[model samples]
Target: MFRRTFWFTSGVAAGVWATTKVNRKLKQLTPESLAAAAANKAVEAGHRLKDRAVGFALDVRANMAQREAELEDALGLHADPELPPARRHAAIENRNKPKSYVIDRTTHTHNRNEDH
Candidate 1:
């Protein structure tokens, strides 16, 4: 008789526990709960996209810098740090100096003469 009573009590407790668990799971599966979960996932994906974009931009900048350096090396245009300041100034001045030319309209010729 005692064994029969104990088994019945145990079965009732187990049924109650299972019902509570199933109810909680059903509540979580409601429309509002599902929408909230989907919104959270979308926000997480946006953050990941932003991070990837930043990484891509940084990589492009680095590659451009490397390419510019290579171009300078190929053209032999790297400035010498040890070059004298006076020579550098003279070279800049020569590059910027304008020239005077005399054109003979009748002869259709160009001549560089100080008198002209």
Candidate 2:
């Protein structure tokens, strides 16, 4: 009799546990829960992609600097860190100039008989 009762209690516990687990799984498989899970996965994938892109950019930057050094060494070029005179002058002039935001939309009519 005691063995039968013990077995009945075990069966009831197992059924309750299975029912709770199935209900939880069903909730998780609902549309809203599934959508939320998909969105979370997408965000995680986006973050991973962004991190990889940034790493690639940094590697490219480092390689570029290394190649520049190698080329400069090969050319036996040793010069000041500043830009050359002409470019330096142009840069200064550009910096001092006020930026114009106006866009020109006027179309000029060209003479058809200007050259043969």
Report every candidate's CA lDDT: 0.87, 0.86
Report the C-alpha lDDT of model 1 over 35-112, residue by residue, as the tens digit. Answer: 999999999999999999999999999999799789989999886789853332334445554555545589875667
Tell me the lDDT of model 1 at 90.
36
Q: Any residue pairs clashing in model 1, and if so which? A: none
Model 1's TM-score against the true structure: 0.59
RMSD of 1: 19.0
Model 2 vs. true fold: TM? 0.69
User: Which candidate ranks first by TM-score, i.e. highest?
Assistant: 2
- What would you estimate as the lDDT of candidate 2? 0.86
Summarize candidate 2's per-residue lDDT along 1-116 as a digit string, tens digits: 99999999999999999999999999999999999999999999999999999999999999997997899899997667786633323344344545564444575446688885
